[model samples]
Target: MNPQQPIKVLLIDNHPLVLDGLKALLETYSHVEVVGTAGLARAGLEVALRTQPDVVLMDINMPQVNGIDAIELFQQQLPGIRVLMLSMHDSREYISTSVLRGARGYILKDVSTEEIVAAIEAVARGETYFSSGVSDVLMERKPDENATPLTIREQEVLRLLAAGQSNRDIGQALGISAATVETHRKNLKKKLGIATTAGLTRYVIEHGLN
Candidate 1:
């Protein structure tokens, strides 16, 4: 990921129009290169392996293998390659599942072309990016009444963790050590009665912690 090199991108969507339109839109940018396109998740995986794209812009709805499930496949095969979900589905379940499955960012397909490019570039840089629509959905969820309240810093850590950030990345953003981030994570889990990272993410999304 040289600063000078254009960010390579792979587009995966079931609709041919969406794939073509996005590829055309992204190609106008000097910083982005549309390396390849696929209409299916398995095919996208093959293309991704061959092209070795810096970022993957994937749709949630596809034939046979959906994008949410495909996320883990990409992560398993291409460890450091960033996956940014671009889909029309904005449901919290879809978004949260994508995060749990290792998506770096989630954006609606209706977003502006520029915003899509921004999301791709941001994720390619190893930073999480969520569309305003996705953020709004997360914000509308109400916390459970009986849930224990968290400190401001703990809430910050929970929000970042739910947004698919690594402990090191969260620590860098909050000006804390990775150990401190882990401590906050443990505290959040203890307070929320959530054991796994995926459970914590689902709780944060359901409670509007974002």
Candidate 2:
């Protein structure tokens, strides 16, 4: 697909209302065209195979297969198909897992039409886009209690975490006890409002802090 041309988009979601709303909203954009829409993963695959759209706006949960699982398939069978996940969830596990599995973007269903359109265009251009719920936690400055930026040691721990380092390994590398490393880990979680290691990793990488 030419970068300058209107991007062909395919919508795959279980909710009829969502599909209808998306179709109607996208119809207003001259640079984007909704080529097809599907309510199930199987149907989505069929639509994709038929339409060969440049981008896919897919929901996480569908009838036959979830969007994350289907991402690899589209990458394999429908090469060059940029997928921007349309989900109501902004959980770190959900969003990060989708990106780790090759999804180009993830946006919540509550997103503004402009945000949705921006996400589609960005994803179609081979860039990554995360909704406010996800990006705000990482990119936006936090309040007073959370205002303090991570310390050098905390940043080191985060980089190691992004590198897949275990607590013991991080301790060894930092010349600190594993218990202290564990403490730093917990602090990291509290400060970042992140629970899973994957979430921390994603935050670190996305902010280029790793």
Measured against the true structure, the TM-scores of the candidates, in listed sequence, are: 0.73, 0.68
> What local lDDT score does residue 87 receive in model 1, on the 0 to 100 scale?
83
lDDT of 1 by residue, 113-196 (tens): 989998988888877788999977655334356987888999899888876788999999999999999999888777776766
| Cα displacement (Å) at residue 15, model 1 | 0.7
In Å, residue 4's CA in model 1 sits off its true spot by: 0.2
Runs in model 2 deviating more than 4 A are: 137-210
lDDT of 1 at 180: 94
TM-score of 2: 0.68
By summed lDDT, which 10 consecutive residues of candidate 1 come out lowest?
136-145
Q: Which residue pairs in candidate 2 collide?
A: none
- On TM-score, the candidate that comes out on top is 1
lDDT of 2 at 103: 77
Best by lDDT: 1
